[model samples]
Target: MDDAIIRRHLSVGRLTILEVLHDEPGIDEDQLLAEWIRRRPPASQAHARRLPRTIAQLLWQLRNLEWVDDTEGELTITALGEYVREFARLHSPSPFASRTSTVGGHSA
Candidate 1:
C-alpha cells in the first residue's frame, strides 16, 4: 500500500467517523464500528477482527489530539478535525504510482 494512502486513511478515518455521527446524532460505538466495517473492502476473518481495534486506537488518538469531543458514549468532530480533513482531501496522493522500499528481504 502507498504510505500516503495509509496516512490519509488514518487521518480520514476519524473525520469520516465524526461526519457520520454529525449526520446522525446519538450514534453509539457499535454503530460506529458497524459503519466503519461496512465502508471497508472485504477482508479475511483475521483482518476483520483487527480492524475494530485499529479504529478504536485511532479514535483514542484523535480524542487525545483534541480533534474530537467524546461525551458519554457519543463523539463529535472538532473544527480542527474538519479543517484538516478538508485539507487532506485536497492534497491526497496521486492514483498513479508510489514509492516502495525493500528491506530485510521484504518489499514495502
Candidate 2:
C-alpha cells in the first residue's frame, strides 16, 4: 500500500485536526478539543491532556495552508481542506485513509 498523503505534510497533528474538521465542521475550539480528547484511546488519555497546545499548533498550520477557516467562533473546513481531505482518503494507504479505519485495513 502507498503511504498516507500526510507524509508530504508538516505533522500527523495537522492531518488529524483536518480529519476532525472534515467530520464535524463548524465546531469551536473548545468543542474541537473536547472531541479530540474524547476520541483518544484510554491508554493515551493522560497524554491527550496536552491536546490544547497541539490543537493550537495544528490550527495554525491548517490556517497557514488555507485549509481551514474560523468565523463567528466556529471552525470550518475550506474548499481546499475538503479537497485535501478527500484526496488523502482516496489515495492514502487503506489503513490511514478513513478517520475511523483501523491499522489492519478495516474500519474501527
Top candidate when judged by TM-score against the true structure: 2
lDDT of 1: 0.59
Please state the error at residue 40 of candidate 1 in Å. 1.0
lDDT of 1 by residue, 1-108 (tens): 343543434444555565566566566678878877766543678877887787688788777766667789887777765655554455555321222211111221
Query: What are the per-residue Cα lDDT tens digits for candidate 2 across 54-78?
Result: 7887887788777889898899998
Q: Once superposed on the true structure, which residue ranges of model 2 sit more than 4 Å away at CA?
A: 1-7, 42-46, 95-108
TM-score, per-candidate, Cα-based: 0.65, 0.70
Each model's C-alpha lDDT?
0.59, 0.67
Please give the TM-score that candidate 2 achieves against the real structure.
0.70
The reply for model 1, stretches above 4 Å from the true place, is 1-25, 93-108
**How many clashes show up in model 1?**
0
What's every prediction's RMSD, in angstroms?
7.5, 6.1
